[model samples]
Target: MMLYPSIMKLMEKTGSRYSLVIATAKRAREIEAAAQETKNVDGARSISKAATEIADGTVVVFDADDADSADEVFED
Candidate 1:
């Protein structure tokens, strides 16, 4: 049912579908963990939120060379 971000839009940010999936999943997990700690669940689901973040440029996929700093790409 999700449609705002659009797959093509997300793919444009991420070079490929595989990369997109990886980035989204990782962000979703982070979102879920944070929600658990704060006991808050009033926003979009983690998967959708992660996709939205990619579309909005709040998160990005880093190249292997930058793997060491990959965790820093996500911003609140």
Candidate 2:
């Protein structure tokens, strides 16, 4: 996804770690499943009190639509 490169660049520039949060109206399982399909995604966690944890200094990457050829960003 176009956002991936920017997100990665931000991470590199800030020297910070990151996480992904899926906020679609879809079921949590579906969101997790979609994230599971992504490499270097780390993993998906509930967005409860973890919201603050997720909202830390790290940058949040968003994909307006389903992720497709965007996976190339994580490639060597």
Best model per TM-score: 1
- Give residue 34's lDDT in candidate 2 (0 to 100): 66
* Candidate 1, 1-76: lDDT as tens digits: 8878999999999888989999999999999999999999986799999999999998877767776677564441
Candidate number with greatest lDDT: 1
How would you encode candidate 2's per-residue C-alpha lDDT over 1-76 as one tens digit per residue?
A: 2333354544443334432334312334544566678743554453322333233533334454425533654553
Alpha-carbon error at 39 in model 1, in Å? Answer: 0.4
Instruction: Give all candidates' CA lDDT scores.
Output: 0.88, 0.40
Candidate 2 vs. true structure, TM-score? 0.23
Model 1 stretches with alpha carbons more than 4 Å out: 65-76
Model 1: per-residue Cα lDDT at residue 18: 89
